[model samples]
Target chain A: MNKQTIGFAGLSHLGIIYSAASAARGFSVVAFDPRTDLTADLAHGRFPVAEPGLDDLYREHSARLTYTSDASRLAHCQLVFVALDVTTNDSNQSDLGPLEKLLAEVTPQLAHGATLVIMSQLPPGYSRKLSAKLADNKLRDNQLFYQVETLVFGNAVDRAVHPERIIIGSDKVGADKVGSDKTGSDKPGEALPAHYAAYLKAFECPTVLMRYESAELCKIAINCFLVSSIATSNTLAEVCERIGADWREIVPALRLDQRIGTKAYLTPGLGIAGGNLERDLVTVQRLAEENGCDASVVTAWQRNSMYRKDWVLGRLFASGLLQNTEQTRIGVWGLAYKQDTHSTKNSPSLALLRALNAYSCQAYDPVAKIDAGQFPHVRVCDAAEEAAQDSDVLLVMTPWREFASAPLERLLPRMRGRKVIDPYGVLAEARCRQLGYQYERLGA
Target chain B: MLQHHRSPHSPLPRTVILGAGGFLSPVLQRNLQAHGATMMALGRSTIDLTKPGASAELAAHIQPDDAVVMAAGLTPDKGKDTATLMANLRMAEAVALALQHSRPAHFLYISSDAVYDARWSSLLNEESACEPSDLYALMHVAREKILGQACQQARIPFAIVRPCAIYGPGDTHNSYGPNRFLRSALNSRTIALFGAGQERRHHVFVDDVAELVRQCIGHASTGVINAVTGHAASFGEVAEMIAALAADNIMIDHLPQSAPVTHRHFDTRALALAFPSLQATELADGLRQSYAALQPASGLAALSSASPASQKPATKKEEAVCP
Candidate 1:
């Protein structure tokens, strides 16, 4: 099982993490992408996504990993996972064209009895139909499977290495049953296909076997629960602001409740900015509408998300600091949506900048680069303090940990005015107030 | 065995029963075992169909040559709400998914007579329209379609048995039918009826339904067959029959009707055509057997003139909505 080669199609974040982790697990990995430049960059240790320890893990396991643009190379591997990060349109609907094209290229090259696992986000019923379609092409039913990927953006490496449970959707009955070995393996007591089970055994986690549709829906169910938690926090945090209560103080009590455990996404933030959450919400809404399932709650989530996206901008307009906007140079800290990665899709910082088009904005982020043409009135600064220079107001939007340790005394001299709006409470509130700055934050 | 037993047919194939915890599954399991067939009964403890990985768990136990019988479902006694319906559908989904992967040689789903249009006044057959009046019936209708489609796609021979109100010893539902009538006679010595129990419904014994399942497996049958006795007796008549069979004098009382009086009659020609030699037990005899089987051992010695030797074991049936 350890000697079996694993193949990954598509060089998205999901593909990179799984490929690197597979290599780290001591199995030879073939990571393929049709894009030659992307494959070349990967081979040269240039990754397209950033995650803590991702580069180090890849560099250390480089000897076991193969980055290639050739589909034929996957034929040598016994198990392959289609780990394409589903691309979404502006409306958050998944565009499955690339995934279909990738499957078309890779399926023909797969070895006989090679397992094909889809680890991408998919609409329900898609996997079963895909299995049928593949069966039409003479592929055995057991050859195809669906696996739910639960990788988080900033923590991809850790999640890849340490999944709480591995959910593999297979048509083969008892494929996930413990101590069951009915996969027609000649070897005694092999539950799943010997190669597939061996690959999963490397993870040393509970493996769940289910139908493709259930597994596909399980991924959406996870995102929906997360969206629900975020919506709950944002709604309650708004109520706290009016009643003189601190959301941070209430979080501890909520965490103690068994129903709402420590991992609950209770912190209120600028609505759902990343495409993943919004895409799931939209998918649910569409599924509900199509099936006549009442999804009023899903609609409410979208409304809440839209209202929360403008939290920073709404606070800015409500404050009189923007009254003399022509004379004001605003300092904006952070551009990426909630940090750790460079993606800015539907970012609240960008939304704030777009709304403050009349003013000259000075922004500095540790990584995320802004498009100059999109925000012509904004100037990208070299350092956090440099953005504060000659600025009347400062807005700490993304809660990057480094921003918490910024020198307060140095910032006081750099800033022209004393208004500090830190929605995430990243900086010290007592120090900002003692420095004679008007510190405004959500939920008191 | 009715339905033209394939002469020189192979012995009963290995049978895997899903929803073995339900009232009828165990009975069917016993019948298959009695017929010298290989049986794997998957009760809730073995594999809960509503769980996350149930499909895989169920598929693992089933073999390519196995004949699978899916008799697991929630009755109206649980609830008639959408949630219950979804739970039942989830169970069916698990079976359908498992069948797709397992690709068994034969698949049979135990459906209900409730799937027929509640408004149908004429004799119902397999071709009758399925316009279920409630969620429980709708769940069965949906399940039949789900399992039917999966079997068709997998090329597995599929059969459906939509039995009428099934009543015998060890009945769990005790719905407003013969089961309830007999239990009331024994427990309280008072048989209560809704609006004089005027609504007539077909009630088949549990054993008969199990026999149909056995024959269906033996013949590798396809298509739908109603597991009915071709007997429609009013609730009042069934109560009276139980009262006659009981050792103690059972008083019959009529309560005000909650709904309008309705009666269901099934055309069992298909059942006859499928299993030509199989016979459904007469209602009077079934009530006598049920009354005797449900009585306590000490009470059996003092039983009424209804002799056990004079009666035969009854047919197995499904649930009929109460009026």
Candidate 2:
């Protein structure tokens, strides 16, 4: 069988990884980025996303993959993946301008039989509405499909290469037709095309072919479930400690049970970050309110997340770190929600820093520079040691690789105060104690 | 299994099983009983280890020569929640303090593989540098350190066991290790997998863990040891075995990998060296035992046999309210 040509519109982080993975899988991939500079840079092997193995994958599959600023390049491909990383605001509302612009530019170029799969994380029903709008503009009903993108920033290459499952939401007939053609031919009385099934099958993952709404809901549902678990875990972890029960021991057993498995988002941390879970929660609550569904569960999830997000600040307040200390210099090691990603959308570290800035705060991220333009009071230092210098309290927020392995002896001298609040527990307690630093870590 | 008998009138060797209501609590209780050891199963209801002075309070109850297994901490329930993670850490600190004052003969801590970060190549052993990804792991590392230091200062025996993916019979909370596969199989539900099932894992049966703890009680081994099966099994193989055992054509759906890739494989050589003759139950046999244990007649019989009137559900109003 001849290999299929896949085109990715909007060469953002998702596009870069997905297109590279497709090309790695021996498919002819054309990646179109609206930004000419980015496309040119990518052509020269410069990647926008700081993902492991992505640059290597791009270099290895450079011949099979093509980067272009030209929209017309997508016309030749059998499948088009609208793979843009949607931007989320502080309120967890997604600004779909990039996606909308990409869709508007690429919809005109989509061929008659071509399948357009929206492989971007969007609010539920957003894709269906977009598809309907495109259909109104004379596009066939089955031509467009909405598929959820499940790419973690640091491990985007792995996610793109091997997705857990692929969900496609479109009309059934269109999906069947596309799937049938791809799988040679449909059997007698074969299930009708699940409009999204064809697009999902194109990715070669376990396909969940459903209606547009369900596909959208499926994505949000997964995030909601994760957020819920995170909130519950965070809330109960405190209770476990307070009650003398070990949440860690309870969690393993919980994970062992099928109802809550090891994969369930149960690790207690700085709460939800990267905008995915937050966005889903917001979208779910919005949809629930609109449809008059009981959104209390989701609201509670959000509240718990917000509460847990401020947990560090709360600890600082409770620990008397901020008491009577007017010029308390707080050093924040990480800016992103988790490590290896530059995204600070709804980052808990930033939230804690904002609280600390009420006094005085110094922050340093290995990748992200704290924008002085946004927070004029905050100082963005060049190095972790520099950030710790003269700092009254050191908050290890993001579990960055560098922060985890940083030498304590080097950091200790730079720190003005002995109190170290390492939520990620990057520094070993034994070493911390040996150095005579008063340490605070979560779940220790 | 050798049945050792102790006179009922004679007091059994006092053993304090910390976190007695935990997943391993029942098994620990049973194994201790089999060993003719008196067990005090301390559940969270009786203790709040995260509170200030919890350790001092716990120490007041501890008697010299009593074996205290610190198996308590905040486990990952949903994902990483910072507050809960901190609380678990605090509990560990309390446990460490208690260990300091009481000076128990044996301090066995149950740690998780989460303590090791993704930088680990091949199977991580006991000597692996503690680079925890999540807060729970971080706290465990902290707790282990605090206990280790206390043990060193007090000159007491301390054994730290880090188990990876423990699963077996009598696992009620079914989300970790092989229980996820078994639970899905039992429910006739689809088991969704993330990424390729290629990430190596060493799943030890809970019974094995219980036995390992029992062996660690009087063993000369000190410091950290990976308490797991010395073999790595792919997620696909485990899922398939569970499906086959279930006799149901359950679909194993591979989903996109959203979380960080935690390629966990542990070397149990240190554990073996510590507890010689400790044999891990094979994954297949363990699954078979787990599958059989999940039977309604076998697993739920105790709960079911109790009169309905005897079992009273906690009232919504009576639920512990979080601050």
Chain A TM-score by candidate, in order: 0.95, 0.89
What lDDT does candidate 1 reach at residue A154?
75
Highest lDDT: give the candidate number: 1
Worst 10 residues of 1 chain B by lDDT: B314-323
TM-score of 2: 0.54
**Each candidate's TM vs. the true structure?**
0.56, 0.54
Candidate 1 structure lDDT? 0.81
Residue by residue across B73-177, what tens digits does model 2's lDDT show?
646652458887778778877887787888876677888877887474454666667897767787788878878888888777777778787777655444535
TM-score of chain B of 2: 0.84
Q: Per-residue lDDT for A166-231 in model 2, tens only?
A: 666665434443332333232311333332233345556555556777778888887777777888
For the second chain of model 1, what is the TM-score against the true structure's chain B?
A: 0.89
Q: lDDT tens string, model 1, A1-444?
A: 277889999889999999999998889999999999999999999998878889999889999999999999998988999999998998999999999999999888888888898998888889889998888988863388888899887788999998787876766645344232233232321436878877877786767666676777788889999999999999889889868999999999999999999989998888887788888888888989999999989987986787677777656654546656468789999998987877888888998887777688999998888999999999999999899998888999888887999999887678998899998899899999998998988777
lDDT of 1 by residue, B1-323 (tens): 13333441579888887765566765786787777877777767678888899999889988999988888877787677888999999999999999999899989899999999857545677877899888888899999999999998999888889999998765666478887777667767998999889888889998889998898999888888998876688998888888888777999988989998888987654654455446677788877777776656624322222332232122222311111
Segments of candidate 2 deviating more than 4 angstroms: A173-204, A324-326, B1-323
